[model samples]
Target chain A: MLKIIQRWFIRYSEQDRKLDKAVTGITGRRPYNIRLYRLAMKHSSVAAETVKGFKESNERLEYLGDAVLGAIVAEYLFKRYPFKDEGFLTEIRSRIVNRESLNKLAVKIGLSQLVEFEGRKRSNLSHKSIYGDAMEAFIGAVYLDKGFHFTRRFIIRKLLMQHYDIEAVIETTTNFKSLVIEWAQKLNHKVEFNISETRGSKHNKQFKVDLSVDGEVVATGNGFSKKKAEQDAARKACEALDIP
Target chain B: MLKIIQRWFIRYSEQDRKLDKAVTGITGRRPYNIRLYRLAMKHSSVAAETVKGFKESNERLEYLGDAVLGAIVAEYLFKRYPFKDEGFLTEIRSRIVNRESLNKLAVKIGLSQLVEFEGRKRSNLSHKSIYGDAMEAFIGAVYLDKGFHFTRRFIIRKLLMQHYDIEAVIETTTNFKSLVIEWAQKLNHKVEFNISETRGSKHNKQFKVDLSVDGEVVATGNGFSKKKAEQDAARKACEALDIP
Candidate 1:
């Protein structure tokens, strides 16, 4: 039994070397524990057989990675913005870790090409979050294999510093709806959103949303969705009111 | 000006030593960066004045600690329960780290006696979550001072392993309503909770709730609140059905 287990591990180690090369190409660091990276890439739908009847997927790793990533980001922001309040820190962190942001980051890091999932038909049909989930699981794998400071350096230097434009993210007010609402609340004013128009076909529709503050229409915007339109209008309103 | 600044540091370090002794007693380890621990014990309401006009409070540290604690817990759960799914892991993590749990743990570690806050009238009026928040901030301090491995050992050995009974926590179904609902969903069975009776005056009211599964009554419970009554009913129902 011991010999058989050793042989099995040797076979898997060869497979792991190829993956390590790919991971090194992206991360600029060879992984210490290749099994973690393998598990990180594995999707829940394609569960591998284990001695315990079935191998678990990247879900747990994703969960772990998400938390670790959050801590790294929070610590980074805390140190970077010394005079900034908790609210500012929270907003910036939210902008950084939001689903859309992570998904975009995942795609930029070539994660879409590496994740192990079912065929394109099944994956594209239902798992829009697969790439982002894999990105998080990969981070978890890095943390487990390399520890916190190393993971922090990888995130800061390799991912955020090398790839991302932090200054642009800070300057942009893309999540205008939330920002506008928050600003209004701070000023003790009521804010309202109204869907003024919905046009075009069922499949390809356009929405016009009007944002009002203290019962006065402040801005109007049009987009493919109500949420988008509201955000657009809120952006214009913030620009007009000098909300910063 | 230089002499004044030097004097301030001397005074603060003196205070920090007392705090260090208290922390040592709790963790069985001497803290290296005593300033972080000092910040952890200092509440926001009593912000100390500094040469920079106002010294920052523990709020930022609390935020950092909360994220670090979450990561630590996620790592612990991930390694400990290899067979458990993400949902099960999340549930157990929540049980360990939720506000009430942390508050209890904080009191157990004698944190309530060491924390510095405003006088009774100010702190008692609003800062109910002080203990739990300080507990998180202290964890953050530990991470910053000692790094991840030492922090992990401290949490696993000093807090979770030494102080907490992990097996009892796993076995006890404190959140019966969620458990029963999860079980019902797995079996494709409908569950309904109805408040059967309300009695007594406005300030001292009682509620009786009945839980039904698949249109049949499974159990009944009574309590001071509707939520409590529902939970009571769910607990009995879970026992009756032997869902596990």
Candidate 2:
């Protein structure tokens, strides 16, 4: 695959060798398949045209990649920071693995140099999200080539363990209820969650809550479980205040 | 900001100079203050427990990062794929730049390295969403350090421009209505959303939709909006089928 991408990159890139070397320098742990890389690079504009009447592209891979990446990262964080709660986990993750970040990372690793687009839309294209999708595709490629254990090690070595405060980062992203409450306290205000009712039974109890600050409801939420309910309620409050 | 971060990373990463080079290489063009780095690294726990009693974690930064990331990614997709419509753009952004993705990226980029913990719950504490939030904090740091231009450049270079066929990926995510139809067609089943109408004028309209598959009513939903009604109906159907 790397050979194929090497061929493809050689064909279009002005600084073909340099680009190849740069991308390879960072990603050359294992070679990527050319066919996959081709699909990764060809914009939907050209790829979706259906060569040989085939309707396949990297869409499924991207979808899978999105989920797989989330699962992998979630598992990693889960193991790395056992003390962190859900809210902190959610917010921090929102910051890092986003489409924009992955896309930017892909470009930094030189995926941009390999991309091929058409339709005279370079200056006016709408395929920006592809940047990250391609990165996922690349991950998919690596997964297929190297397997999960290898991929995990590669990600940890190249990505996670590279630089991080795993303990503190995990702790912060985990607790949103605390985060919101803490914020309200900082404002020197009393926070109250007016729970109108806990409607369901113990097995499937649902709580309806309205979180308020200084008498006005800031967030309304319902959850099947009590803890989830309070967290949901707090999350709503945070969103309403635009305060993480 | 980059200079400060570079210097700090170089100073801290005394053993692995390769990582130092990688960190400095990514942010070589900018110069950020140590305060920004500290803020980026400050998980809410440490910030909340500070001696000054000032809770100044990246939580606020996470909030800002979420919105800014959304706007920038939206704009990027809009420009990158000139032919795509609003729904496509939104769905792609939703999938690619979701909280889960951001969390993964944050962890990938070492946001965990900056967190501060509360109790000794590190052993059993496990929350998965923080990586993205830290990624957002990092974005906040980048924005604070380099402003929007470089921040935009940073996101583009790192995240969105890498892999997926952005157009098709977006198209795949957009328009659940069409998706249902497409899925039904593929399954050789008739899928109909029967909207039983209630009386209303131009200003107010109420709709009750009975979503059916293969002539069997699946779920019913009532909404002022056809879109909402459809979504609720779809959600019910999906829930009924335990889809995903």
Candidate 3:
């Protein structure tokens, strides 16, 4: 009985220490409400519950965090690229907050060691996206605990500046729509994309996008998303016309 | 010369008085940077200028305001609807902040009387969206002058509570996509949308959507936006099939 009691105490203390370390590591301060941080780290697959008996998941926090992150990123981009148009700002923001980018950032911030989820949830959850979700939830928790200004500072100064190469991202990213538009402008040709047909059931429908150059169909592409199909068609048109 | 000078003096004081009234009406506090508020009310067509020699319009401020508004709205929705899924929250947010809604809200706040733009600019600018843009710029100015916490409180308590019927919006606003999905489930039938064909040029393309029910095309719709086209198709399908 004494041995069992000792084991339980050691495990409990270890867990407590780990949580404290994570709070300190992420926020650079002692947490005001450790429960929020704890909830942030708990993935929905674990079915976490609040002290008030409300079923809890990081999903709501993720939503809030996503907005917070967007606002901060938008402000940073707006100030950094004062002369850049809204399209440029939006594209840069997307590149920064995209699932792939966020996933990488979350791992960089040591969330991989801290987040909790059931192994079974791995069936549907991509290994990377869950971490991204958790990162958003963590930001949401930070927003709630310390408020927007502090969260903005944490995201902009601590997370984004520390991890992302903003200049490199701006230089590297290109939109196919812009590429097609530029090509059209240079060649003095008009290009258009129209949805000739839509197929499938409501939610999981497929889009068939046809790209036309100077009133002639140049290429066609298919995707579940219209944007994807449009991009696909543009890429093909680019390849076919040798206008890279 | 004395009469001309007197006229200029009177006009300038009138403009100053109008600005002060506008600020007090919108923010409920005296503005610190009156120039920012003036810039917020200035439309691009008017070609307003700052003392710093930058061509001043509300565009950059609009971008900042959009992000700030989105963050505040997201937080409000997150807290108010704890159990709602991300899609529901997103749809609701879209309803509240859409161009049409914001335009109306801007007018409600008496921005129509205050915002300045050239008559020539009005030819291309849809009367509604310009106000919405100005509203966002106004919010951006508020965020800058007052900080995030104050801006958040203004958005949530002053703007939203005063102007909007939150419960009515939550109850009445139904996404066409969601409506179709629910109808399909009730009838135990499968439905889908597929993009069969696309036409037009790159940026100015139209979407053609065909709604299929039980392996047959029931209705077709065309629109500039995919979502609009889809909603059109869905509504037609709903009407034809008596799927109310």
> Which candidate number has the best lDDT?
1
The DockQ figures for the candidates are 0.41, 0.02, 0.33
DockQ-based CAPRI category assigned to the predicted complex of candidate 3: acceptable
Candidate 2 per-residue C-alpha lDDT over A104-195 given as tens digits, one digit per residue, 9 for 90 to 100: 76766667656655653456465677778777766655555555556566666665565444555534433768888899789887888777
Residues B1-244, model 3: lDDT tens digits: 4433443444335776778778877789766666677878888878646543356688888888999899999999988987776756886887889888899998898876678888834563556688999999999888877778889989998889999998888756336657877898888878877775577789977888887877788888666777767876776776687775
True contacts kept of 2: 0.00
The list of candidate 1 runs beyond 4 A from truth reads A1-9, A12-17, A49-55, A121-126, A177-244, B1-14, B48-55, B121-126, B178-244
lDDT of each candidate versus the true structure: 0.82, 0.61, 0.79
lDDT of 1 by residue, A83-176 (tens): 7656557778877877777777878887776677878555465466887888999999888877788899989988878766877787565668
- Per-residue lDDT of B28-91 in model 2, one digit per residue for the tens? 5534444555555556765654432235676756655665576567556645754543444556
- Judged by TM-score relative to the true structure, which candidate is superior, 1 or 2? 1
How well is each residue in A1-244 modelled by candidate 3, as lDDT tens digits? 4433443444334665687678778778756666677778888878656643355788878888999999999888988877765656877898999998988888898976678888833463546688999989899889987777788888888987899999888756336767998989998999998887798899978999999998999999777788877886886787798876
Cα error, candidate 2, residue A64 (Å): 2.4
